[model samples]
Target: MQGGAQLPLPNPDSTPAVPVSGHSANGAAPGPVVQAKESLLAAAAKARKEKPAETEAEKMLREEQEIMRNITSRKALKSVMENAQGISYTRNLKTGWKPPLKVRQLSEDQAQDLRDRFHIIVEGENLLPPILDFKDMKFPAPVLRQLASKNISRPTPIQMQGLPVILAGRDMIGVAFTGSGKTLVFALPLLMLSLQEEVRMPLEGGEGPVGMIVCPSRELARQTHEVIQGYITAMKEDGLPELRSLLVMGGIDMRTQTDALRRGVHVIVATPGRLKDLLHKKRMNLDVCKFLCLDEADRMVDMGFEEDIREVLSYFKAQRQTLMFSATMPMKIKAFAESALVDPVTVNVGRAGAANLDVIQEVEYVKQEAKLVYLLECLQKTAPPVLVFAEKTADVDDIHEYLLVKGVEAVAVHGGKDQEEREAAIDEFKAGKKDVLVATDVASKGLDFPDIQHVINYDMPDEIENYVHRIGRTGRCGKTGIATSFINKNQSESILLDLKHLLQEAKQRIPPVLTVLEDPLEELRELEKASGTRGCTYCGGLGHRIGDCPKLRSQNREQQRNTKDYFGSGGFGGET
Candidate 1:
């Protein structure tokens, strides 16, 4: 490599000519040095005159540079150490997160191949380390034990890529199917961070939680809390620190949650609404929170919780590791991730807005009045442990009532229900006491209920993502399930294109009604052409039907008048 190059020096003796009446003194023009000097001066002047404004990216880059400079400064280092309480915040914590066995630097081709293989596309630095199995990246003994106990010998696609990113302490937005074990992707990291930092359960009214997991629904919140507790139990068995995890959500007593907060929990799994309420009341503080996980993040954004999520994010003082796990990646989610996550590594396991392939989808074009009849028929054919999704709370209530009157064991849950009622309904459904659970979109995402034999769409969801989520209730964890959609004209047209695409992708049969919109028949087109016009069908004349033609009316009127006049005269002559 060429080390360094030197600039050509100007002739030392080169001098500018003294112009005497547009003539050089020595009868020679200016030397190259003088020309070069003049050019340099002119370029300097032009640059100063045309200085461009700094852009946002440039500003951020400069800020990053400044931060790097400051953090390495002696004074800044001293301040950070003082704040660290004499414990250095090392790059490698005691979390048992070791670097990969052998880091192979991937070429561009290799990275592209890997990305294509996993449907993974990262936006940040190419910092992904490879791991062939769960054992490749060494986890804590207790965590590994819990995994073994659950017979989780291998990692899923999301888990495989997600664990490395989470372990490396980089924010991520994981997009996978509903049953792709998204819960554990963040749960394992949360446990690791807590254990590595030795975060203990806070004393009564002493400090706030160190980790916060915000879910979209109460059942999911409780479910996540239970999973965390499982890991906590394993940690205790391993003689690690005991952690307290709380499930904070609405439809429950605020006093109880406040008391739990006062008892000094290490982790809080909550829904956005209740969590924001607690934040407003000053009952919970997230200043010390280090791990923030948003499960079913796309659903949260769709439910109009963006502002609440942003407000919750405002409470964090120090920089926190944020992870978002969503089943579908909507534009809203992508935009939210842009604002919420910094250089997040996006792990998309498959195509977005696609339903699980294991689900068998069937669409019936039934009118609104006959939906109940069809639903009843479907219920008769389907087995128990079914989930029927409605678009409205009133519909859910009506279905629940109708089912009860029909002597079928069923329960209802919607946004209008109290938290206790929702919990009880979910509990009954989970315990198999109730074979059918009628619900709104509340239970669409993040609520894990295994053995859901069928997911019935009593009313087609307005959004495609909701439809995916509705059907996603079943077919979880590699289980074969059926999804029956009762799509009428009202829904069939608006969602016909998306529905067809989804069905095609899932390898399900597309109904005839959904096809005409995509590929209309020739006969149907001719009939539509005739019916679509305003002219009479018989004569092809505008503004009148064949039965009410003006020419025919005149002929009939003339005949009637002439017959009356002539018949009257003949009768008069005969009488004379």
Candidate 2:
């Protein structure tokens, strides 16, 4: 199992406890399913006795409602499942072979014949099955030449799948290991559609461009923006009709984004929140968007941006081609696809949630207190170009301080750090002035620093899936990478377990040691006991899941009772 940080504390609330795989709160195996029912009742009673503000309870209820709303939204889910039987097509153009060239000395007629032959072959080239190409390789030339001047010569598998689908103007869902060039998958297509449109249509003044790429993080949006810029640069080089692009995301002044959008961009890559903010105000238009791509679709779900995604899509016509790309496809991703796409082509480049092929993975079982020691050992051993991902802001600070004390050049990046510090820290890391960069999720999104050899998860992610995102920082651009995590005695190993299942499914081997690892359930129970309430697994509440909740049950029973009363109490149920 991948290692995880078992939270030290519990929530103090009257909510049913989550049945973690570890021991129960009393340091014993959970007595029984009956005991679970009793504990929830007890917790509920305790919460009532505490008589906390109704306002807090109300807030909690609202958050829960929103969470379900986010999950239940059928758009992405339906779009995905409806297409789940999956559509298949075949092309025999060529596999593991390049297009043939004949530059050998030839007569003019032969040259013309060769050129005609090239066109005929390309026009008639039968493409291969999607699954085969996804297993390996990058994009074709028209896309590569555009990427080359941008200095990106090789394509990742995600790009390979996405580029084709995007150009075909079909809905697409791309899932692969993180840092597998997922951005280019959507961005290149976005550029192709727009730039190609600029060429095909006499933009002699068609209302600007007709595609948009939306991302959740500012850094990611910016990374995507830069890639688009590279493509636009290529377009200009090719002397194609001029294409324009812009970035719209948070932490940046809206005035700038508003002005850029007002000036008109064919492709606007923005964060969901900010983009929605613009859309609601009638400043952004999707009425003409022929193509749309959601980069990091899973992050938007995790960051709770479903409403924004829906809101943005609501502005577009259903006929628009939508593409959603994520490093990993969780349930939320399926839901997002349902709401957004159509009978689209689906591409699975790598086994979902697995580490990058370039990244070597490892874990060490250490005590929470000893996490610092192992981190130091890793820093000392690594040749200094490394990144450290901490699960919390405090951990980021502590690790940064420790590294500083060790005389290792290091800096931290997170939400609490001022914009200047954050930017400076990223710049320093990018400039190679910092030996190590300690960060939170902020660094995990869309960073493209080259030569980074190690990604250390200082703290394992609470959501097991985030493991893919955090470790994505290294092993990018065809480079080899390594990821190491420190696991303590009480930390949750569900992540490792989940990862093991995912990897083994992909035909990767599981470590023999993991087969006999400590009990995850017991560890979770201890942590939950330490925390006032077992962190709510249902809606991530403090103590309970949705199905087991008393309030929900009461609502159901009340609903049934009211139905009987309305039916004239034929003891209606009996009569029926």
Candidate 3:
């Protein structure tokens, strides 16, 4: 274009290039496939120079368009490259290789030994499949290549057991720690199945996705979507049919997602509310979705997504596989699984409601008013990349601002903030642009941030499970970390016994006060044992009942005496 800012030429290496394995007999380069590369580049440059952004929204929209354009161009280039003579489709598939089913059936003693070693318990017909190594599984070469590239030689305890059950066409429940590779336990199997099904029965028009992953929060949904995208890219490069994945969640352009839906997606990683919105609006459908996964199922129930989940599930057709994964299995989660899953296999890798053993835990008995002071001191002494947690959104913001004013780079994520702000805060923290992240329990769940060295509970969470997840932010993926909590009598007294027990179980040092606080349950039992009726139901005081309670009887007698005195003394005020 004349007198326009010239767009930079696309780098041949910048395209998504896969390794070429085949060579021609003449030992020459593969024939060049023609594409409108120069014209597309010029058009993109012209579009950018033709109009200047007038507002923030406009600029954001333009940026999004540019990104989409770039992605489309790259995809086109990859297609052209794949069509070259030396690069053949289906070359990445390990032909005729399958995982051994003999290992699937283990003797009772062997299963027991395996359970003891990994703390894994399998329920329901001993259906849990054992993965001695990643290589033992029947995976596409691209999936294996991606794992090897990342140096993942063996499966985590959760992955080792969970994969087989799902692949066996059975519903499964996985209760593992926060960083136990739970996402892949389902994603890998689902993708492999989708590839097989797509080849066996090509998708009809707008048949929708064969795989669906629902996460509790937007951040977690986005993260899971990214991981799925990586696998999808690897699969595509390895000559599998193009299977598109979409992230349908709040805080992004819904129209873009709708457009993607119109085009058709093979997989969807979404949050409950947004997915419900799309489903209700008739913008998407899940009738053909064969695989369903609820990542962090316990967190979803805790966040009041049970109703939304049910509402979405009502839309799904029968004949689908289901998987539920959580860090802890509460009664609600168990009930949910019973309702959603059919004869599911339960895989528990570790003790439920326990913090990661790798974390160093400590307690600071500070009053609510003084927690800020102690937190400041702790921050001053601690290293960077710390995650501070608060019980309330307001407190998260306050702590975040206080740290900033004190000259520490910090960010905050909480329910009060919009999705964009929360995402931005998390991005900044993940990028190491911020040294500290002040957050509420919202960030404590399935969101994975790497190398977090410290987790400070500025305000100890109300629930014991929250406490476990909060501290888990630091000690992740088998890394050593520190977790310090600020506790007070008013807020933390009720959970003192359980907290102390958990810390002791993890072999962590407990504060003196925590050890001293009486257990409410034991105290109640003692009260019941001492007195048949511990307290008066009416008066709510110990050592009394409504009929014979001293306080109540005395009040009734005093009222009668007052009534008699009023009638006898008033006698019409001398001449009644």
The models' CA-based lDDT, in order, is 0.73, 0.62, 0.73
Show model 1 residue runs off by greater than 4 Å: 1-96, 103-121, 199-205, 519-576
Better candidate by TM-score, 2 or 3:
3
lDDT of 2 by residue, 1-576 (tens): 238757656667766566565567778866544334457889998989999665544455456557656546554432232335442223211112331233223354653353343221111122222212322333334445655655665445555434554555556677766767777667765665676566666443324347888877777777778877876776676656778887887778888877766666788877887888887887767666777777777677657676676667666543566677776664435554654555555666544445566777776666788888778888765686899988789889988898888888888988987766887887788888888989898888667776788889888775555666777788887878878876554554544554544444434555654556553334344544554333333322222434344433544465565464445546564334
Better of 1 and 2 by TM-score: 1
Strongest candidate by TM-score: 3
**Compared with the true structure, what per-residue lDDT tens digits does model 3 show for residues 1-576?**
788879888887776443354544466776554443468889998999987757543443355435334423421111122334333222121223344867756676776787678888787763655676777777878999998876677888888888767776777788887777788899998788778778887776567888899998888899888888998899899898978889999888999998888877888999998999999999988878778899888677656676687677667654567788888774334544655566668888776555788889988888878988788888865678999988878888788788888898998888889988988999998999989999888888887776888889887765566788888887777778889988787763435555776776788898898777655344344444554323233222222223333433554455455454344655632322
Checking candidate 3 for backbone clashes, the offending pairs are none
Q: Per-prediction TM-score, please?
A: 0.71, 0.65, 0.72
TM-score of 1: 0.71
Please, what's the RMSD in Å of model 1? Answer: 22.0
Candidate 3 clash figure, as a count: 0
> The CA-based lDDT of model 1 is what?
0.73
